[model samples]
Target: MLTSAWLDGLSLGDPIAADPLEGGYASRTFRVRTALGGSVVVKTQDNLPENLYALEADGLDALRAPGGFAVPEVLRVTPSYIVLSDLGTSEPSPTYREDAGRALALQHQQTADKFGYHVDNYLGTLPQRNPWTGDGHTFFAEHRLLRYLEEPNCHNQLPADDRRRLERIAGNLVNLVPVQPPSLLHGDLWHGNLLPAPNGGPAMIDPAVHYGWPEADLATLLIYGRLSDTFFDAYEEVHPPSPGWRARLPLLHLRELLCITAHWPDRAETVQEIHTILEQFD
Candidate 1:
């Protein structure tokens, strides 16, 4: 429950109203109206990990550093809640997708010598381990794919044979994925994370930022089947994808499917999806 005292503590003006928002898996989100005659978005949760909100604020800053797309301005961030400047959104349009694609390509141009971030961050509520690794495939295998196997939901839900199959795929990742530079990845790129900016362009929110293979971000966007071909076309204009990337798409998305399965052990469809992908490689 949001109270006027909490808003007063932040000195963000008096709280007029706080309307509940949908689609927040990690926190309770609200579009808060203030007596200052402006509104902001507030995301709050109790007993969060020590640095969750702080790390998220850092990610938004890092994303903005590339000057590629628009990210919300972090007004105030505490362990329990964060206040951000409201960027009203609209429905997705072909032009918005095209703009977003080009923007994302430009963002990916900011590369690093190693594949990982300086510090680890969260993907949803799960800790995403990102130790600096020289090899891309090794980083993706160890940090992105295999790391989730330790979770109770992931370990218990998968049978012995299925686990072995996943391990086999991880071992063969070097052969399956292409050699690519360590590009800045949105880490959790999907349609839901991208809001339709009021400026008739794309605005990114809720990012899990890192430096890794750009194809991973592309794979995430493709898996949702929401964005159209126009986005890819625009992206290619700025930065073309590596050869054989299409064939590796399913394999690249394995990390996300694994993460979802961990968060929702009861979602049988996610388990089936994992099997479906594993079957493709066998």
Candidate 2:
């Protein structure tokens, strides 16, 4: 097999088989199978930031710390390439969804003194700032929602009124948002990012991780589609959400929808979705 330049640099001692795998916006991915019966994923980027894979590696380590949930094991990393244990992708059963909920709730127990992450990370190609803050509303307003408003794509996509309303929403967040201490979060958890585990449970990939409200994770689940009721039932049984969480789902969802609008130009529906949410708050 003709090895790609990245595979040559990896220097894995074992001979391997490689197959192309699609689905990353910023990198080329491949699934490699070894003669020794091991499978790993390798991603290569021509202009990736030096810490991209390293940050992902750190997030995987944190998610794996709680056990039960599966996060790919890091094998090799560099600015150009990252090799990780290949998590299987299969349609999950109802039991799998329930376990995913249970495991995520257990992971959420791993908390921090404040909201935010110790290190700054990227959500796709966009920078996600995570300075520690004593309050969740301030963190969400400053980092999650308003930060994207300044982006060039954001200005181009959202009209002046939509931008102003988002600002108004941010300014009044203290009253609209409920207070909650920080919990570990898979900052991006839309359905496409979810992978079924080899053990028949859930394993997540491409985490934009932080210590934030656990409900933010739940909100992400709802935006694209919902998991089985068993998932929420199991999660609540382990770590119940605040009393009025369902009402706040749109507010939490506004962050990701705005991010999608800011990052991708042709996604008019996503831009309209952000407009709908911001107008709802008005």
Candidate 3:
């Protein structure tokens, strides 16, 4: 249970109730009601070795900077907790694809000189293997995918044909260099992670913030399922993907699939989805 002292420090009045919010595999999220007749979302994680909630607060602030998108306003942050302005239980806009694509393009315009975040954060619940020393492409290929695939659980889960196909795709992906300028990325922009704001615009959460190929985010969006035709249409209107992005889509998705497989080996359905994606390249 959260103590009143913590609420006092957050400037929130006496609490009414603290109820759990569904979703998210990592932090424990709660919708807190205060005596001031207001509400906010508070996320807590007891097991994270690193200050992940603080990192998320920083990333959200960065994305909400002057020209950034309409991200959720972070109210407060502590080593053990993060409080954010709640958008309530409003359903995320089905137009998420359109709004999100445009919003992300706006975010990419806010760039820095380097190709990575100032501090590293987790991807979902797993420690993201970011390139602290090498270039983005080399780091993703050598350190991220190779190491993940070499794990016994990940390797054994792939059927023989699917495994060969993934190997080939990985080999081909390593050779193809990305020439595009690196842009700020949400890093994890799937449909589940994007929610609609009260103003009808899209709001993003659960970012695996980074600086890398902007197309990588778009590719991940396409991998799970199209965000909606409206989304693709809007995105293309702002910042169209370079030629051959469709072909590269599968390659990019392979990285995410491997990450999920490594983290949740027991999810048979997820494994099958990974196999289904590889089959598309045949």
Each prediction's RMSD over C-alphas, in Å, is 1.6, 2.2, 3.0
- Writing each residue's lDDT as its tens digit, candidate 1 over 1-282 gives 566754666666898899898775788999998888878899999878878989999999899954488899998888889888888756655678788989999999999999999999999899999899999999998999999899989988877787888899999987788788899888899888888766767889888999999999999999887888998999989999988777788989999999998887786888888888998985
Report lDDT per candidate: 0.87, 0.82, 0.72
- Which runs in model 3 stand beyond 4 Å of their true positions? 1-6, 90-97, 132-136, 150-152, 159-168, 174-178, 276-282
Model 2 poorest 10 in a row by lDDT: 1-10
lDDT of 3 by residue, 85-111 (tens): 888767656665577777777777666
Residue 148's lDDT within candidate 2 is 93
Ranking of all predicted structures according to lDDT, beginning with the best and ending with the worst: 1, 2, 3
Which ten residues in a row are the worst by lDDT in model 3?
Answer: 130-139
lDDT for model 3, please. Answer: 0.72
Model 1 spans with C-alpha error above 4 angstroms: 9-12, 90-94
Question: Which candidate ranks first by lDDT, i.e. highest?
Answer: 1
How many backbone clashes does every candidate have?
0, 0, 2
Q: What's model 1's overall lDDT?
A: 0.87
Question: TM-scores of the models, in the given order?
Answer: 0.95, 0.92, 0.84
